[model samples]
Target chain A: MATSTTRLPRAVDPNTVNGWGVDADPRNDPTYPFRDRSREDGPGMAWQRPPLQEPRVEVLRSIEHSRLPAVVGTSTPPKGLSGMIRRAAFRYSESDWRHWLMLLGADRINVVEGIFEDLARGRIPNIPAEMGARAEWRHNKLGLVRKVAIVAAVSAVAVALLRRRGRDDW
Target chain B: MLAAEYRGPYRMRAGRKRMPRIEHPRDALVRVTRSCICGSDLHLYRGMVPDTRVGMVFGHEFCGIVEEVGPEVEKLKPGDHVLVPFNIACGQCHFCKQGLFGNCHEANAEATAVGGIFGYSHTAGGYDGGQAEYARVPYADVGPTVIPDWMDLDDAVMLTDVVPTGYQAAEMGGIQKGDTVVVFGAGPVGIMAARCAWLFGAGRVIVIDHLHYRLDFARRYCPAEVYDFREIEDMAVFVKKQTDSLGADVCIDAVGGDAAGSALHTLFGKAMKLEAGSAIALHWAINSVKKGGIVSIVGVYGPTGNMIPIGNVLNKGITIRANQASVKRLLPRLIEHVQAGRIDPKALITHRMSLEDVSDGYHIFSAKLDGCIKPVLYPNGGQ
Candidate 1:
């Protein structure tokens, strides 16, 4: 692996920040805590918008990144590929997501270790372009697999639809 | 990193809230000079993403001056004016070490679990972004691109996301010398992708979008031929004709989210296609490629749910690469270019307003008013 590259030379830690507290501000007037009261028709209560979220990054830093052990039996919102594969829009299988994780060489343990190490010592890339090249290759490789799967799925659905249409005509 | 968060889903108030701060010792506080609005910010406003807190400051693409540094910081100084990469990475992590800052474990850890961004959500690590009087930037020394005194922060800010993202798209799409590359979207990112594609030495870069204004923008700004996907049919054929009857060697879906990806799904259908959307770009990426060609995805994906067909990838010899746009990868060189006046991303800006007029600017951008492309906010300009 190359030493680290410096796309940004003066990045900082956000964790030590404070006072950006719009949290319960008088700015919201009657609805102090919640902002964006456009939908203020919630009857007596303020209809505030929720915060933008993407906790997958934090989860990836956890011990159980790829394997979700059910978050203490309540099913933990079904994280990782298992949960995502269930969505109809994505059209991917569980194994596919797993394969992608591996293909990208991303693992929970490694991710955690890498983050700490990078923080411990500022990281710089020796072959920065190569890194992008690798992602390009990975995305391309995964895209190929996804296309094939979608084609097969769509083909099956098309054939079934045709059969159902024929039966209906009968 | 303390993100000067733009809390969407919630009406944004014009003020700086520095609630979130750096937890690690390596963090630094940044005095932001310039920040730009991202198209993705619209998603949060529309509530497509869930649970985004209202107090989140909303700047993602920005460049600034380092006001303070951590004890462990080695590469930066307090006075250095720098561009902050959208994703904050420590630069030495396996992914960071590998130059994939988009997937930087520390940067997107929380968001990956929930699929989100700065001021976007707790799922996205809830980092403070640089849309304020002061932004505490994370991974300070690693990702900041020092803007030479001669360089403009407005132009330098492009190094944060759009420009690098655009270049990453071209690289992912496998643009080769003299190859035709089709970018599906003429939004700022799409335009940047075209610009980057041309920069990568591609021949006849083509861009597609529904907006005439944006298409016209691409025709005027990008080095590629432009097409209107809304008015056209048989896109593959049209693109192929541009490539001497050969399909585009590379396809980039700079369009993001389910809507954009779904539009692509309907257009390409089940045929051989390629994509570069948010989470769903990988789905059609393979189908659009020319046999062994490539698809490049640069848009940011939401939390963990992504489904792509894998079997065809095995059959068709196509490859799909994605652009996380490693900031560290481009910082030095991008800074050099900016100082040299070779690239100026600020050309995308068409609207400029004070921090107080952000609501009006947002309205203009939201309505696509008067060919509004990129809107620059000057928080310090007026009372």
Candidate 2:
């Protein structure tokens, strides 16, 4: 009943949102969920045969000997989609584009990281009991840290401006 | 050193909830009084175990106090200080009784088809790990070890892993009263392998590692000759130069990855006397033998494959034997050596730590992995 007459803040124009960037629904807008396509088969079945021993033999052959050393000690800084694009450009070739590679790496790892965070948090959302039962998990690299940082920084800025006006209103 | 929980590659978070308690009736609750982050643990850390759920208590090498026991568990009681054998062997199994505990059907069945472990993958049978406040010890009578109150938990912890593993390597090495042996990879296990080689009567023990720290230890602590691989490029050329260009009587690839393998070629490149990868002692035993020589493997292998040529393996006419070390059988002897001061797997213990300092423990050690050989953790120092 209190919702009957409550005033709402005006919505931001889509053209002006986040510096006029395209508002793509990252979770489901066609290119979302990061499907490999090579692995899709109806719904649930994603697990391959599990290793029978300690040294997991076949971990992504394409990511051979050198790929491991690629992101050994990394930390990412968030700068939005444009920032991510810029970082990827830089990593591929030397130019004003180098920063793009960092963004790309961050963006790529972040998408994977977000879905993975729940598992990292030990939520154990309806999986084979044995999956969560093991002793180790992967690590969060610089990318997720960057995204979280950007979110924090944006919120902090928004709060600061509202405070400057000396009003509780946004 | 750092046994943080992981979700997959790049999804590590600080665990907030206290890890779960022993849930099953057959479980034996053992607080991880002493544990270490194993090299194998990194695979899970790297996200190889897909479906890897979060909140994994990561660690396996440990010695602990019996905090609680399952209702059916009559062999152990509280206050008993013990070492957890890396694999949970069901003493009732055929292979377990025959000393092939690693392949015991029940033991392997319980661990990701490979059986239960302290802190390992679902493949090892999804038992929760010991890296946290506690672990659920399955097949209790068979895997939980009994150590004395006087023994340092650090030394006892090796019985859970490298001590037996190293001794098993020597036993597989099949050394007579006197023989020449060369072991690759001076990581803690390699050093221990060399030490055990000396104990097994290797007239000449040569250890190979790129790290100066480990080779220096080998030179100073053990009687084995040391070969710092950083100085050498070719395995055959380097090893041969060391043994009058004849190659070692037994060559052990304590080194993982490219130690003996050339992945680019999908075959063995320059021939070395012995080979070891998925099975370090076994490769050495099989290929690096003296026509009738024995090779023993005690290294760790996950799902990775060793591109060994089986025909050549047979043609070599050598003795090859490797498996998960029979930890229970080897522990008592390893303890006697530790007690007798004949060997100090403890000296291999370069990092001494407590649970609170795990971050530093994981880092400094993880940073210089090959350099920071063995680290021992103690949760409760009371004992």
Candidate 3:
């Protein structure tokens, strides 16, 4: 006894069907399943509660005024101790040093390319006198190639910890 | 102009395109008027999402009208009717000024994996979605909204993403006053996360699935307790033998990574893609919650990781929580839980077709056939 069948392929078009348009509106199609006409069974919500978290108290009052402290005043010059030892040895976060200098390929973010070339030469200056002379010539050529790659990685980790303390002083 | 067309894995096709505009100054466009078909677009229609781009156009929830707005759009105009929110935020970023609009650090160029999800492809911010008949909308007054005048564009297109991803999967399952909760996928975001876990006072909710028509449509639309984990054979020991084993204080995993009864997890996550599909309902919500429970996870995995057990979520002291549903910070308490009738996101739409039969509504919703749960799609030039 054998009985086999396989036909499926004509993906669509039984005359494009076209009926449930505004997602069914014969007054919302006899309310087919609007959870059996709710408002907990009537009066379509004569205001009984809900809506108080007023958009979570206006998004926590705009995240408490965007965590305050940025009243827009920055004319550069206040980083004394060699810019706090280069912000504590480049410990990142200006959006993680612009995504780690754009994953090391350096997508040129000298403060967003000196604020888009000083707003395309119309100058809205924060520190743009040729953006502090091309950011002091790209921070003195990236601080002499990051201080010679951190003094050649701390002199190859202090010569492998002094050759393991000179073989434990032999 | 018809649309949708991915062309590969479980192929989608639809045809005629090109008609979107205003590429930026905070673009707008829209005109879609309803578009659904999300279960995270079946993880890019089963190729299991990862740079899914063969002319992509899947729909990320949807709802429309505005039809043009860009010179830096000031809160929508030309004919309004909005509803967007499938996270593409950028209202001056630090995560959309901390309402964490789904982590929008300038709308996803993989904002460190996931943040811009419209048509769920290009790992989510390659834009292009609203399954067609127009849709551009980036940042347009921080993710659409409008649709109020007494709602119902089928309940504002399930408030753009299955009722704020099933009300943030029962508000990240904190579910206090009676907490038992359970969930796992019965699908329209697990019947709105078991009807928002009875508005978070769940003394017991349940759900599970293996489909007896989505456990009889989450037992007539959720006040929970539906089952059929293929008639349980150790579904985390039948949910800790129905709770007294001190389990379920909350366990969500609304079925991400295409989970299904394991046959070595559909032969290694749907035929050897390695991982990111068969997490088997996050390994049965980290082995059926309890010892310090609270799982949550509004499902849709595959930005690459997932084979999770994490030593049963660190020895079941669980807590987890998950995201992608910040839908403009839960749209004014889900439009006042749909105008206080208390949640009726269009009774989870059963089916409706025509954006020129969107490839037969994505082949009867990726072949679950007739008892399909949510479908909706319109866009035949706004009918």
Candidate 4:
């Protein structure tokens, strides 16, 4: 609940909003209420696109946006077994984890309980650069190779089944 | 700069927030005048909706004065009073062109489960909502409409969501002349749907809810026949008997997940998370509708499966139509209805609070304390 010092936009003339009252000409259509001032100054209305700006300040939620490998499935995990059980029972439900994994494009079974712990703790730990720690992070926590293999196997099975179903239906 | 924050399920903290600024040329900064705690917001508050990130602001039903306009913004300008639809739509998208503004393609990059919804989770779109003193509105030209000078501000705010959602619920029912329609759930949407059913030439409308207060409110507001599900021995059978064993012509599911009734449904759906919260209301809707009847769902279901009786729908030859209400598409006729005194949208407001007291607003509404039907938040503290 932090505050920003940004000032509010200044108001234009009350009488001549959107070039309506003071600037209305006989040649201009009266039925049309007002012309956009943004159009008058810049690239007119036709080619105008929504310009992208700097990304907004990220809100620090209970869950971090990035992957927390150090805390995810490492040997030295953050929470106790009872704490994990409590979270599973009380704070974040099974459905929430499943939904989170699905949205994160990760396998539900592969996601470790430490990921939930990290979420509960409200801080994302950075990945260690040491070779052994990196190996553990890669092999134990993410298991990227296994994930890819599982995905490929699943896709192959799904394709084979779909083809078989199509043949049977025909 | 006060805003409502999602601390966790059933916990909201109202405190100071960083002022939102225009992040895109299509974005406009709105100084929120009126924002309401919607029933769907309760779903997020209750931890029903997925990806409801903590530290998220949670008010989608709000109207405000345009504090600033982006460079590319054409229609709206500074100082205009505007009502913003919950669904954000990029006007040039395929869905928006088809008047399917709810499913706008460009506004939300996520899968098509939902479009960009203000203050909804990242599942909808990560954009902030109008629950605070200032909110960044994207695609401002498409979703926001100026509040007409003659319209009451409270009524104008309702049109942004609740009014149109209810109207769309009834509209989706395809209620023919003299059709007997039964609406499930007596919340604001259900009541509005039942009321709108009359305008669609419904012969009789019946609303069901377990809560006596809501049923009573439904009866008073919509003037529809009311029933408490707790009193009824069987919902499907009761509706059938009311309609001479044929069931009602159409049924609407206004209650989504977190519906209470069967203990098994609660255990499996809510507790187990095997499926979306108790599909009890949806099951009742499907079972209670007559053969060849339509079931319109405006209820807020979660981002996953539901154990609904699809076999019943198949056997009964039911037509199911469900979507988020296309508020922009239905606004013109609804504005006419509201202006002509046919629908009193503001009559539903039961409590009003300043944005500083938003957590209290969420508590009273969620707990159903103080006979609260609808609670509106005033960011500028006018009312």
Alpha-carbon lDDT, every model: 0.54, 0.52, 0.65, 0.71
lDDT of 3 by residue, B276-342 (tens): 6688887888888877677888888764455767887788778777887888877997788678767
lDDT of 1 by residue, A107-131 (tens): 2222234335445767532222212
Error of 2 at B158 (Å): 2.0
Which segments of model 1 are wrong by more than 4 Å?
A1-170, B1-10, B16-22, B108-117, B258-286, B304-314, B339-341
- Judged by DockQ relative to the true structure, which candidate is superior, 3 or 4? 4
For candidate 1, what is the DockQ-based docking class? incorrect
Each model's TM-score for chain A is 0.19, 0.19, 0.17, 0.20
Candidate 3 CAPRI grade? incorrect
lDDT of 4 at B268: 83
DockQ (C-alpha based) per candidate is 0.03, 0.01, 0.01, 0.03
Candidate 4 or 3, higher lDDT: 4
Task: Please list all clashing residue pairs in model 4, or write none if there are none.
Answer: none
Structural similarity to truth (TM-score) of each candidate: 0.64, 0.64, 0.30, 0.73
Which consecutive 10 residues in model 1 chain A have the weakest lDDT in total? A1-10
Q: Candidate 2, residues A118-154: lDDT per residue as tens digits? A: 5787765332112221111222234436655898999
True contacts kept of each: 0.03, 0.00, 0.00, 0.04
Question: Taking the tens digit of each residue's C-alpha lDDT, what string does model 2 give over B1-383?
Answer: 22345444434433443544444444577866778756556445544332233445567788778888867677899878888988766665444555655554543321222444555643454455666566667666777877876787677777787777776766666554335677877777777777776665454677766677877887776655676655665555654454454445555545443343343322331122122123332333344344444455555543324445466456756555556667876677667777777767677777776655455445444445435777666655524
